[model samples]
Target: MIPDPTVRLIGWAVTRTAEAIVDRAADRIATKMKTCIVMTVRHRAVAALPKRGRV
Candidate 1:
């Protein structure tokens, strides 16, 4: 059986690594979402504007 200290050390390392990866991924996803939302809003606003000098 593995020693208690060794197991604790492994668990701690794994937890820290996972947390780091998740944090990085969350930041990237948030950035992309914000960009997409802003672009979509701008596009809709421009499209909704009335046409000028048209029959």
Candidate 2:
């Protein structure tokens, strides 16, 4: 149990820490999603390009 005098500060610290963790996780997920989208587009573009000189 937290003491009354410091409880507010403690709660603030915990909340801030949780928010930071959530923010970092969100950033990582966004980066991975962006990378996946870019890769998919690249693959599609390459596949759509006209092939030449194949016997």
Point to the candidate with the largest lDDT. Answer: 1
* RMSD to native, candidate 2: 1.9
Mind giving the per-residue lDDT tens digits that candidate 2 earns over 1-55?
A: 7788699888999999999999999999999999999999999999999988878
Tens digit of per-residue lDDT, candidate 1, span 1-55: 9999999999999999999999999999999999999999999999999978868
Candidate 2: where are CA atoms >4 Å away? 1-3
Give the poorly placed runs of model 1, Cα more than 4 Å off.
none
Q: List the residue pairs that clash in candidate 2.
A: none
TM-scores for all candidates: the values are 0.72, 0.88
lDDT of each structure? 0.99, 0.96
